[model samples]
Target: MFTPVRRRGTEILDDPNADAALSLRSLRDIALANRFFGGKRAVVREVATLLRRHSGGNEPVSLLDIGTGLGDIPAAAARMAGRRGLVMRTIGLERAPMLAAAAATRCTDALAADAMHLPFADRSIDIITISQVLHHFEDAEASQLLQECTRVARMGVVVGDLRRSWLAVAGLWSSSYLLGFHPVSRHDGMLSVLRGYTEPELRSLIERATGCHAGVTHRLGFRITAVWSPRYRRA
Candidate 1:
C-alpha cells in the first residue's frame, strides 16, 4: 500500500502513453472522486459565476474544456447552462487519445490537443477551463499552459485543482479506500495531492506567466480555484 507523501513528482495518469485500461480506470475513479470531493462542483460554480458576471445570464457562450476527462465537468456545466436559459456550446480537449475517445462519448465535440500549443485562434474561445490538470507540470510548464489558455479565452479562464495539504492527502486517501478505488487510482490520487499548489503559489505563477491577475480561492474539500479574465468582475 502506497501512502500519500509530501514529495513532489508526476503521477502515472500524467503520461500521454499510459496504459489504456489503467488510464480509463484511473479516469473513472477521478470522475467518482470529483463527484464526491467537490471537483465537479467547484468548476461548475466558477462556470456559472462567470456566465452570470460576464453574460448577464442570458447570452450564448462557447466553452473549451481543457484536460477534459470523460467530459464530465463540461456536460454538467452544459446542463446547468440550459436550466439558466443560456446556450453553452462546449468542446473538450484532451492530450491522451484514449481519454479523448472516452470524452467523445459524453461530449459532442472532443479532440486530442496539447495544452501548451493549443490549435485555436487568439481570443476564439469564450470561456476556458482546466480541471485538476496543472499539478502534473512544473511551475514553468504550468505557466506556459495558462498563457495559452488566456490567449484563447475571450471571457475568462477557470482552473480547478487540488490544494497541497496534509488534510487533502488524508481526505483523498480515506475516500479512495472507502470507495474501493483501484490501486493505480489510489497511487495517482495521492501523488496528485502531493503535487498540488497552494493559493498564493498558483496566483503568483498565473500573474508572472500571463500578466493577468487571477483570483485564487480556497474552496471547500481542499480545492483551489484560480480565475482570471479582463472581463471578470471582482467581488
Candidate 2:
C-alpha cells in the first residue's frame, strides 16, 4: 500500500498541446500547491544548502530547474542563496514553449527543449533541480532524466517529489475543492499524490540511475527530497 500507484494517464498540465489559458490556470494551482504544501520548501532548502557547501566563493552559480512550471521554485532557491550571500543564476526549462516563455518572467533564462536529451555540456551547470516531476516518468525514463542531471551538474542535484500517502490524498481532495481549484487542477493534483514514491523507491531509483547514494528526507507536507553530489562513489 505504500508503493506508488501505477497511473494510467497523465496530468492535465503535462500536455504540451493543452489550451493556453487552461494550462496557465492549472500551472497557477500547481504553483500554489508548491507554496502552501511543502514542494517549494523541500526543493529550495536542500538546494540552497548544496550551493553553500559546493560554492567556492561569492561567484555566481548556475541552476537549471527541469520541468519548471512557473519558475517559482527556482526563484525561491535563488532568494535562499541570496540570504547566505551566495549568487545563483537560475534557468527554467520547460518542454512547452508557452511554459518556457511564461517562466522566463522569474527565471534568468527559460529553455524550451527536450529534457531527456539536455542541451547542455557535461558538468556545465553548478546545480540542477527537479521538483514534483520525476514521478511523471516510468523507471527507464526517470533514470534517464537522473543520468542527464548528473551529466550536467557540476555540484549536485536536488529532487523533490510527493511522498505517497493516503492522508495526503484525502487532504488534497477536500482542500482543492475548498480552494475552488479548477476541475482539471483538482483531478491532476489528486492523481499526482497517487503517483508519488516512497523513500525506498526514490532512493533506489536515484542510486540505480546515477550510482550515487543520495540523502533522502521527508518534509512536512508529504514531500520527499533526495539530494546528492554528482561527484560521488557508487553505493
Clashes of each: 0, 0
Q: Mind giving the per-residue lDDT tens digits that candidate 2 earns over 104-154?
A: 989999999999999999999999999989988889999999999999999
Per residue, candidate 1 scores C-alpha lDDT tens digits across 31-116 of 99889989999999998888876544565788999989888999998999889888888899998776798999767689998889
Give me candidate 2's TM-score against the actual structure: 0.95
Which candidate number would show the highest lDDT if scored against the true structure? 2
Candidate 1: residue 75 Cα off by (Å): 0.6
Candidate 1 local Cα displacement, residue 232, angstroms: 7.5
User: Which is the leading candidate under TM-score?
Assistant: 2
Tell me each candidate's TM-score. 0.92, 0.95
Error of 2 at 43 (Å): 0.7
- Angstrom error of the Cα, residue 180, model 2: value is 2.4
